[model samples]
Target: MRPFNFEKVNSGAEASAAKSQNKQFVAGGTNLVDLMKKNITQPDILIDITKALSNTIEHQNKGVTIGAMASNTKVATDKKILRDFPLLAKAILAGASPQIRNMASSAGNLLQRTRCPYFYDVTMPCNKRKPNSGCSAIEGENRMSAVAGYNNQCVAVHPSDFCVGLSA
Candidate 1:
């Protein structure tokens, strides 16, 4: 990964205030770190919001409120979620391995990058990774790519099964 300054913020407001063109808010670094290592993202400042964000799973009126920083494992194993949203819990468990679930955050999962191979390879051209760079996935192997909502610019599919479950 490129050399960058890390800042730990204690609140969303502070994170927002610190965010700028060269800064990014990071909760779980699972996805962001990978992208950075691949040179897909090079933020000058990384604002860590994990400590500042709530990790609680609150049961609201006929629904649940999962904190942005709550890990997938926490959400899957939470008594309230397991009891009230069994399918959701199952879906999350089915998505990633146990170790990843323990470190991956709910919000971070939703915002994770596409699983397109080209997107992660700095040597390959990808529109999503670099606008107007030309899409290499279009003519390459794309069995896992999207069939809908795809255009010339990008055909990458969202790589989160948790997101699919949440949407359902």
Candidate 2:
């Protein structure tokens, strides 16, 4: 990962105001850090939003409000979440491992990138990795490729169990 400026904000508003081109908001750094290490994404600035966001799960009149910084483990084990959205809880528990789920933030999980092999390989031509480059997964191994909501430009599938559960 290349050297980047690090800024810590104390609120969501501050984090939003700090946004700029080639800047990434990092809470748990589960996805962003990995992408940085692989050179998939190189941001010139990293806005640490962990302290700037709420990590608690608040119950609301209709349902619940899950903080963006809330960890997967917190959401999966929260009594209200388990009672109101058991499927969501189960899905969160089913993802990654205990350690990863503990560190992966709710927003990070929701914003995860596709797990397509071609997208990870820099040498491979992937439209998702580099737009207009061509999608290698379209003609290559595509067992996990998208069956719906896919165009000719890309066929990659998001690998987030929590997202699938939320959709259902």
Candidate 3:
């Protein structure tokens, strides 16, 4: 991993102001850290927003408003979520292993990248990983590729158990 500057912001406005072309907001660091290690992303600055963002699960009149920084495990086990949205809880629990869910944030889970093998391989050409580099999964092994709603740019399927539940 390349050296980078890190800052912990205390508010959304601060985080937004700190944003730049070479900077990225990090919450749980689940996806961003992995991408950085893989060289798929190389931000010069990382603004830590885990504390800046809300982590509470709010009970609304019609539904629940889950904070972006709330961990997947927190959402899955929240009393209101389990009582009001049991399916969502079940879906999140079904998606990632217990350890991952405990570390992954709700917002981070929603923004996760594709799980395509080509995307993870820096040596392989992947349009999603590097635009216009060409999609390696097209002609290569594509069992996990999308059946529909795919273009030449990408064919990987979204792999988030929590996302699936939220969508439903």
Candidate 4:
């Protein structure tokens, strides 16, 4: 991973205020860390938002509020979540491993990047990684590419089971 400056903030406003030219907000560091390791992303600044965000699952009159920093495991295992959003619970439980679910935040899951092989492989051509570089998945191996709402430029899809559950 490339060397970068780090900052820890205590609120969403603080995180937003600290955003630099090439800054990324990191909470669980689940997806972002892997991308960083692969050199897929090279942010100049990493704002640690773990402390700034709430992890609690709050019960409200209309519905439950899940904190952006709430872990997938916490959302999956929460009494109210399990009772109210079983599909979401199941989706979260089905993703990654126990350790990953324990660290993957709900907001991070929603904001996670594509799982396209072309996008991950730095040596490969990917429009998402580099605009107008050409999309390898269009003519190359595309088993994991999107089935709908795709163009010639890209066929990448966001691989998040939690987001699918959330949609329903």
Give the residue spans of candidate 3 off by over 4 A.
none
What total of clashing residue pairs does each candidate reach? 0, 0, 0, 0
Poorest lDDT segment (10 consecutive residues) of candidate 3: 143-152
- For model 2, what is the C-alpha lDDT against the true structure? 0.87
lDDT of 1 at 102: 90
Q: How accurate locally is residue 136 in candidate 4, as Cα lDDT from 0 to 100?
A: 91
Candidates ranked, most accurate by lDDT first: 4, 3, 2, 1
**In candidate 1, which residue pairs clash?**
none
lDDT of 3: 0.88
lDDT per residue for candidate 1 within 68-102, as digits (tens), equals: 99999999999988888888899999988898899
Give model 4's clash tally: 0
> Candidate 3 residues 77-139, lDDT tens each?
998899989999999998888888888999999988876878889999888877899888888
**Candidate 1 deviant stretches above 4 angstroms:** none
Give the whole-model CA lDDT for all candidates, comma-separated.
Answer: 0.86, 0.87, 0.88, 0.88
Query: Global CA lDDT of candidate 1, please?
Result: 0.86
lDDT string, candidate 4, 1-168, tens digits: 989999999988998899878999998889999899999999998999999988999987768999989999999999988888899999889877999998899999999987587788899888888999998988887844787768878899887878878888
